[model samples]
Every structure is written in structure tokens, then in C-alpha cells.
Target: MDSKNYIDSGILELYVYGALSEKESMEVSQALQQHPEIRAEVEAIERSLTQLSTAAAPYQPDQVYQQIKTKLNFKDQEVAMIPITRKRTNWPAYIGWAASVALLIGLFIQFDKNKELRQEVVQSQIEKNLLEGKIQVAEEDLTKTKTILSVLRNKDVIEVPLQAQQVAPEAYAAVYWDKESQTAYIDVAGLPTPPPGKVYQVWSLKLDPLTPTSLGTLDSFNEEATKVFALNNANESEAFGITLEPEGGSESPTMEQLYTLGVVNS
Candidate 1:
């Protein structure tokens, strides 16, 4: 393209504005080198833009810009207009960047430590809840024990010993009968745990015709931690016997499965 025509096309303005692609900029640079007039036009455009930019900026004292540089901790820039003995390193820039890196590292460490502390606090709360649950269970067990002891020590309680019978010679039990209240507490600590779907039934026996009356069943033999069970017994009893039967008590005592027999003292 001819120099006058290229200048008139406004491509030089685009070039000055850095709006051209790399290849296009190279082409323009080459054209400017070959045509002195194109180079002069580009320079004129740059000078006018620079003057306009200076005029658009609000007036400020030289000290205002210098104070801004001081706050930024900017060091003395290289003076190309004056000769220097040696190339000066920008120490302020290096120190500022190092301080920023150190500050970031410290913040990261603090954040990690806080996260770890939060996890530890959560773990502690879990352990505290578990300990409190255990303490509650223990307190309940102690309360039951105190109640059993108080029942045994009553003046109205009648103590009776049950001897092991033919079925289980090793088994022995005691009956604490509160005659006033018609409540009999059977201590079956020596009795073995009954099989699944089976339970022990107690009988209040009469001596003459050898009649037996059901006094309910000992249902929770396995889980009775103190091995003591309370049953309602209001019969004019002569003897007490325990026999293993089905889940619910049998219609009459099963003599074959008799584990213990005790005759009440007269």
C-alpha cells in the first residue's frame, strides 16, 4: 500500500493503540521502518495522546506522587540519564514480597491449628456423653440394689430355706415371705439359667393329700442379676417347690422337673 493511502486508512491509529494482532503489528512495524512518513505519523499520534492524557489528569504536587511511592516502599529507580558505578538491586521489593509470603504461611498454620482444635473438642464431647451414659446406668443399678436390701431387712419378712431336690442337687434357694403383705421373694442364686422357651414355676403345697397350688412363675431367670424374684402368694402354705416348665406356667406342678423343695417351719 502507498504511504499516503495507508496513513489515511487509520491503520496507524490502530497500531498506536496496540489494537492489532501480532502478525499485523509486525507488518506495520516493517512498513514504518521502510516508510519514514508512516513512522512520523505514528510518533505524532503518540505525542498528541500523551499531551491529552496529561491534561485529563487532575493537578497534584510532585510531593503527593513521591509520598505514594514512599508508602508503597518503592526504592530508587535506575536513572538511565545519569551514569552509575554498579547496577543496584531492588532490596525493598524483595523484602516486601518475602514479608507477604511469611504472613500467608503464618495465617495458614493458624488456620490448620484451629481446625485440629475443633476436631479434638468434638471428640471430647463424644467421650463425655458416653461417660455420662455409663454413670446413669450404674446409678440405676445401685438404686435397685438398695431397694432389694431394704425389702430383705423388714421385720415382717419370714425366711425359708429351700434344699436342692433330685432334679438338680446343686441348686438351693431361699424364700423371704412377707407374711403381712402376702409377698414372697425367692432367692434363686444357686439355680441354673433355664433353657429358651422354658421357665421356673413355684408351687405352694399342702401336706395331707399332697395338693399343689400355682404361685405364678419366675419368668426372668436369666436377666435377674440379683437372682431374686417377687411373687404374690396368699395360700396357707405348708411347703414351697420350684419346677421347670414351658414358657407359661403349667396347669399343675411338673414333679419330674422339680429343682428344689422347702418345708415351711411351724
Candidate 2:
């Protein structure tokens, strides 16, 4: 495993706590030698645990001795020393063992809390990113809506409604032509969704000579929520037509696949 995955696996904590079996401990030791990062992590864990244990265990030898003497009912007066071998409570040993247990419990609790905190931070970041992405998308949509509204309200813009052709009787679309800016905003909301591997290509037509100029393909048709697209049109277009073409469009209009057509009002 990589160093990061190895460190995150919690085995290093167990190794430091001496809770791992002999074989596992040997393996960890090998890793510690091979990986500097693992060694550093182990050292850091050891330092933290040592600090916690030390802070929790305050050593007051004199106080402990006095307390022990008080508990034993001992007096300062000198008396004959006699060795009595009887079962007695080992208070010092018991206190040391209890302190060790408490230290271990405290370390375990701290480890668990730290893990929870890390998880919370990661989850919070994910949520934050998702919210930001949504906000960005909303902002872009708002900008597009504002631009479209402005175009529609312009007095100089020419509106042409492209009626459904025989190929697709139910499919219709409209074009807002701004001659000043040479921009054509086509609203394809009334048109049916294009099938897979096919796209809707727009054309600027001159009906007098039946000449067709390719504006562009609606490549982002499926992704566009408003079903509106803007394409550059510098040609003196007398008419507009939409045709279904293969992906990336074609060099010439496929007249048989024409979905909509409309002539500019004189």
C-alpha cells in the first residue's frame, strides 16, 4: 500500500501502542525503516501519547509516601523491626496500574474524537464544493436569461418563426436576427430532442437563388436547458432553415431532413 493509505489504516497507532502481535510488530518495524513518513508518524504518535500520559500522571513521591504511611497507621517512634509475611494490599502497584489504565482509556478516546473530527472536515468540504457548483450554474443560467430577454426586447431585432416542415410536422423554432450585431439567437424549444449520433444544424438561406449557408450545429442542444443558441450570421439571409444532420454537421443542407423553415418578411 502507499504511505498515505498505510498511515490512515490505524495500524500505526496499534503498533505504537504495542497492541500488535509479534509478526505484525515486525512488519511495522520494517515499514518504519523503509518509509520515512511512517517513521515520522510513529514518532509523532509516540510523542503525543507520552505528553498525555505525563500530564495525567503527576509524580509527588513524598505525598504518596505520607499517604501510604497514614493508611498503614505507622508512627514515627522507633520499634523492633520484625518481618511479617502476610497478604497485604499493594496500594502503590494498584495505583500505578489504575493510572496506566486511565491513560490508555484517555488516549483511545482522544484518537476516536480526532478521527471523527477529520471525517467531519472532509464531509464539510464536499458539501461546500457541491453548493458552490450549484451557485455557479445558477449564476450562468441567470446571465443567459438576462441576455435573451434583452435580445427579445430590442426594437431593431427581426423575429422569424420557422414553422414545422413535412419532415417533422410537430417541430418548430424561432430566430431573433440582430442585423446590427450580426447575431442570430435561435430558440429551439419547440423542436424535438435530436436522436443519438445526430445534431440539429442551422442554415441562413437566400430563397431567390436557393443558396444555403451553414451557420453551425447545435452541438450543445442536449445540455442547453433553455433550448436557445446564439450563432454568428453576417450573411444577408432571406430565410432560415433547421435540418437534422450527423454529428459535427454536414457541408451542405440535407433537404430531406429539414425540420423547420421560414422566410424573412419583406
Candidate 3:
């Protein structure tokens, strides 16, 4: 383009304000070197900006135009001056501020998403631990049930049914006595729950003179889920009897509180 068209294109104003890209600025620099008129226009724009910055009062277009025409010594009606608009915007400054605000908003959104994901991961791990605890408890209960079934099916164990006595007509029990092991497993499933501070005491009985020897009391009766208890019976017992006694059990049999009785088969 010729000097007159290039001057009117507004690139000189952009170059002076540092708003043009590096490549465009370099092109303008080359044009300024090649053409003396373009160089003079750039210098004039710089001088006008410097004057406006130092001026005491707000700009008046007509006054500034007359000042410029007289300083350049333009003859009347010979040089036509383009009207300069007073309103100018700093586009690069506004664009930089907008980019900073966009970057902050993006960072805040990403931080919120990461926080939600971390909470979800922690909650899932807690649920997994609770499920594993429940599974372990179930496995332990299954093993205990299998052991009870094996004891009941043993052929070598002698089964003796104890009949309910006058003190408790509805209460009954059975004993699976392993003679070789001298271990008596008392199945008290049909008995009622013992009252507080009370316990069931077993006795090894000899019918000839009606002598009774005390076995240990069922201290953990309420806590046993299967209502069965194992007790060591090393005495030569002809009959087995159960009676209600105090917590620690009495040294002798409590005849009035007898609940059940059974004779061993020869």
C-alpha cells in the first residue's frame, strides 16, 4: 500500500501503543526504515501521546487540531486533517485480565471435583471392612455348629434321658456320657432359663444308701447359646440328678429343689 493509505489504516497507532504482534511490529519497523513519510508519522503520533499525558486539562479536539496545524505550519485550506476520535481502548490489558480470571475459575472447579472423589474412595473402603467383619463372624458360627453335630452322632457315647421331677414338671434334660473320656455332656435345651443369682448343679448319686456327691454348678447357663454343658464326672455314679442352687452351689444336695433324675443303664 502507498504511504497515504498505510497511514490511514490505523496500524501506526497500534504499533505505537505496543498492541501489534511481534511479526507485525517487525514489518512496521521495516516499512518505517524504507519510507521517510512513515517514520515521520510514527514520530508525530509519539509526540502527540506524550503531550496528552502531560496536559493539565481534559482534551479538547478543536483546540488540539489548531495547535497541531499551526506547529506543522500548514497553509490555510492546503492540508486536510482527519478528525481524531477521543475515545481509545487498551485491548491487550483487558484481554490479559480476562485470561487470569478464566484460569482461577478452572482451578477452583478441578479442586472441588478432586475432593468429592477422595471422599467417595474413603467411604467405599469403610463399607468393605464392615462386610468382611460380618463374613468372618458367620464362618466361626458355622464351625461351632458342625462340632455339635459330630458329638451327637457318636455311637460310643451313652445317652440317658432325665425325667422331670415334682419341683419342675415341665423341665427335662439328657446326658451323653463318654465313659472312656469320663466327660458328661448335659443337654438342658428343654429347661427354662434360670433366675438371676441361681444356677443348676449336677450330682453323682449312689442309690443304695442315697449318697450324693456334688459336681460343679452350671455357671454360664444363660450365656450358652446351645443350652448344653460339659462336665467332668470321674466318680462311680449309679444315678444322675440336677437341682436348682445358689450361684456358687451348696456343699450338699438341695432335695427340695430337685428338677430332674435318671438312672444309668448297666
Instruction: For model 1, give the 10-residue run with minimal summed lDDT.
Output: 78-87
| Per-residue error (Å), model 3, residue 67 | 42
Candidate order, TM-score descending:
2, 1, 3
* Candidate 1 vs 2: which has more lDDT: 2
| RMSD per model, one decimal | 15.6, 20.4, 12.6
Writing each residue's lDDT as its tens digit, candidate 3 over 1-266 gives 59998987677865776545677778999999999999999999988775665443353445554555575566567434432333434333454567678889999999999999999999999999999998997786677677667678988888888999998999999887888888888888888888998999998889999999986898988877777778898878888999999989999888999999999898
- The candidate with the higher lDDT, 2 or 3, is 2
Q: What is the overall TM-score of model 3 with all chains considered together? A: 0.49
Over 136-248, each residue of candidate 2 has an lDDT whose tens digit, in order, gives 99999999999999999999999999999999999899999999999999999999989999999999999887999999999999899999999999999999999999999
Ranking by lDDT: 2, 3, 1
Taking all chains together, the TM-score of candidate 1 against the true structure is 0.53
Best by lDDT: 2
The lDDT of model 3 is: 0.80
| TM-scores for every predicted model | 0.53, 0.60, 0.49
**How accurate locally is residue 108 in candidate 3, as Cα lDDT from 0 to 100?**
91
Q: lDDT values of the candidates?
A: 0.79, 0.85, 0.80
Clashing pairs in 2: none
